[model samples]
Target: MKKLVLTGAAGRLGSYLREPLTKMCDELVSTDRVDDIGTLYPGESYVQADLSSLDAMLEVIKGADMVVHFGAIGDEAPWDDILQSNIIGAYNVWEAAYRCGVKRVVYASSVHAVGMHLKTDTIGLDAPHRPDTYYGLAKCFCEDLASLYWDKRGVESVCMRIFSCAQATNARSIGTWLSYDDLIHLVERSIDSPVVGFTVVYGISNNDRAVVDNSKAGHLGYRPKDNAEVFAKAVFADTPPLDNKDLANLCIGGPFATVELGNSGVAALGVVDDRKET
Candidate 1:
C-alpha cells in the first residue's frame, strides 16, 4: 500500500504500532489530538486531529489504502465523554475511511463488548454484545458499523476484540494478556489477509487459560506466538482468591464488567508499564 493512516498515534498501543506500520507502507500518516507525537519514523507524518470531527478524520485519511483506528477513550467513563470520544469518534473514522476510498479499517474493539458473559463460557467470535460500560457499548457500535459498511459500501473491516494488551500483571491477565508481539501480529494479519469482508477476531495471546475463541476467524491467518503462562505463578501468588460474587472475577471483561457507568475500570487493573520506548 502506498499510504496508511493510523489514528491514536499518541496512545500506549498506538505508540507500539507506529514504527512497524511505518515500515509497512510508503507513507504512514499518524494522527491524534496532541500537538505532536514526540518523533516520527522514516516515512511517517504526524497530524494532530480530533476523532470526533468528521472533517478532521476525512482530512487525515484522504487517499489512504487502509486505516488503523486505535483512537478512543481507553476506559470506562461518563456517558457524555464516551459518546464523543468513542462513539462519535468511531463513526467519524469509518465514514472518513469510506470516503477516502480506504479498503479496510482495523478497529480496536474490546472484550468489554461481551464483558457480562462468564469467562468459563469460552465465547466465540459470534458472541452477542453484552457491554459492561459505555466504553464497551462503543465497541459494539463499531463492530456493527463495520458490518454495515462491509455489506453496503464494499469496505473491509477487522474488529479486533482486544483482551488486555498489557503485561500479565494480575490474575485476570493470566487468562487475558495479549503480548505486544502478538498484538503486532494480529494487526499485521488483519491488514495482510485477503478476502476479509468483515471479521471479528480475539486479540489474545496463546494463553492456556484463554476465555475467548478465535477459531472461527482462522481465515485471517493470525497465529499468536506469545503466552502469559510464564507469569501465571507470580500473578496467582500476588492476587487474592477470586470472589464468586464479584462481577470482575466471574466475567470476561474483568474489572470493566464491575465498574459503574460513569466511572473508570483502569484504576482497578494493576498494569506494569511495558510501553515501547521508540
Candidate 2:
C-alpha cells in the first residue's frame, strides 16, 4: 500500500500497531483526539482529530490507500457518549473513507456485538447481532455500515470482532484471550487479504476453549500464531472461584455480557493494557 491511516493513535492498541503499520506502507498516518501519543517511529506521523467530525477524518484520510479505524469510546458509557463516539464516529469513518477514495476500512469491532448469545452455542461469523450494551450496539451498527459500504459504495471492509486482547487473568480469558502479537497479525491480514468485500472474523488466538467459530472468514487466511491455552494453567490457578449467577461469567461477552446498557464493563474488570506507550 502507498499510504495507510490509523485512527486512535493515542490508544493502547494504536501504539502496538504503529511500527508494524509503518513497515507495511510507505507512510503511516496515525491520529487521535489527544494532543500527543508519546514518541513516534521513523515512518510514522501523528495527527490530532476527532472521529465525530467528517471533515477532520476526511482530511486525515486524504491520499491514504486504506484505513484502520479504531477511534471511539472503547468502553460502555452512557447513551450520549456512545452515540457520539461509536455511532457517529463510525459513520464519519465510513463516509469519509468513501469520499476520500480509500479502498478499505479495518474496524476494531468487539464480541459485545453478539454477547447475549449463550456460551454453550458455538456461533459463526454470520450470527445475529445481540449486543450486550450500547458499546456493543455501536459495533453492530458499524458492521452494518461496512456491509452497506460494500453493497452500494464499492468500498471494502473487515470487521474483526475482538474477543479479549489482554493478559489472561480469569477463566473467561482462557477462551477469549487474543495475544498482542496475534492482534497485530490479525490487523495485517485484514489489510493484506486479496479480497474481502465485507468480512467479519473473531479476533482470537487459537485458544482451546474459544467459543466463536471463524470458519466463514477462513477465506481471508487469518491464521493465528498464538494460543491462550498455553496460559491456561497459570490463569486458572490465580482465578477466583467462578460465580455461576454472574452475568459476566455466563454471558458470551464476559464482563460485557453482564453489564447494563450504559455501564462500563471494561472498567469494572480493571485495566488490561496492550501496551500503548513507547
Candidate 3:
C-alpha cells in the first residue's frame, strides 16, 4: 500500500501497532488528540486530529490507501462525549474515506457492542446489537455505517469486535484475551487480504475457552497464535470464586453487561495508568 493511516496512535494497542504498520506502507500516518508520541518507526509520522470534525479527519486521511481507525474515548464516557467521538467521529472516518477514495477501513470495534447477549449462546458476526453501554452503541452505529459505505460507495471495511485485550489479570480474560502478537497478525491479514466488502471478526486469540464464534467470517485468514488459557490456573486461583447470581458476572459483557447506561465500568476497575511509549 502507498499509505496507511492509523487514528488512535497514542493508544496502547496503537503504540504496539506502529512498528508493524510502518513496514506495510511507504508512509504510515498516525493520528490522535494527544500532542506527544514518544519514539516512531522509520516510515511513521504523527498527525494531531479530532474525531468529530470532518475537516480534521479528512485532512489526516487525504492521501491514504487504507485507514485503521482506533480513535475515540475507549471506555464508557458521557452521552455527549460518545455522540462526538464514537458516533460522529466514526461517520467522519467513513465519509472521508469515501470522498477521498480510500479502499478499505480496518476498525477497532468492541465486543461491548453485543455484550448483553448471554454467554451460553455462541454469537457470530451477524448477531444483533445488544450494546451494554453508550460506548457499545457507538460501535454498532459504525458497523452499520461501514456496511452502508460498502453497499453504496464501494469502500470496504473490516470491523473486529475485540473482547478483553489487556494483561491477563482475571479468569474472564482467559476467554477474551487478544495478545499483542496476535493483534499484529490480525491487522496484517485484514490489510493484505485479497478482497473484503464488509466483514466482522472476533478480535481474540485461539484460546481453549473462547466464548465468541468467528466461523462466519473465517475467510479473512486471521489465525491467532496466542492463548489465554495458560494463565487460567494462576488467575482463577488468585481471584474470588464466581458469583452465579450476579448478572454482571454471568453475562458476556461482564461488568459492562450489567452496568447502567452512561455509567463507567472502567472506574470501578480502578486506575489503569500504563501508557504505551510510542
Find the candidate with the highest TM-score and give its number. 1
TM-score of every model versus the real structure: 0.98, 0.97, 0.97
Q: Please write out the lDDT profile of model 1 over residues 84-185, one tens digit for every residue.
A: 999899999889988889999999999989999999999998889999999899899999999999999989999999999987889999899999999999
Against the hidden true structure, what lDDT does model 1 obtain?
0.91
Question: Model 3: residues >4 Å from true position, as ranges?
Answer: 269-275
TM-score of model 3 vs. true structure: 0.97
RMSD to the native, candidate 3? 1.3
lDDT of each: 0.91, 0.89, 0.88
Model 2 off-target regions past 4 Å?
Answer: none
* Tens-digit per-residue lDDT, 1-278, candidate 2: 88999998888877889899999999999999999888889888899999989899989999999999988988899999999999999999999999999999999999999998877788888789999999999999999999999999999999999988878777888888888899999999999998999999999998888888998898888889887888888978888898888878877888888776788888766656757667
lDDT tens per residue, model 3, 205-230: 99998888999888999999899989
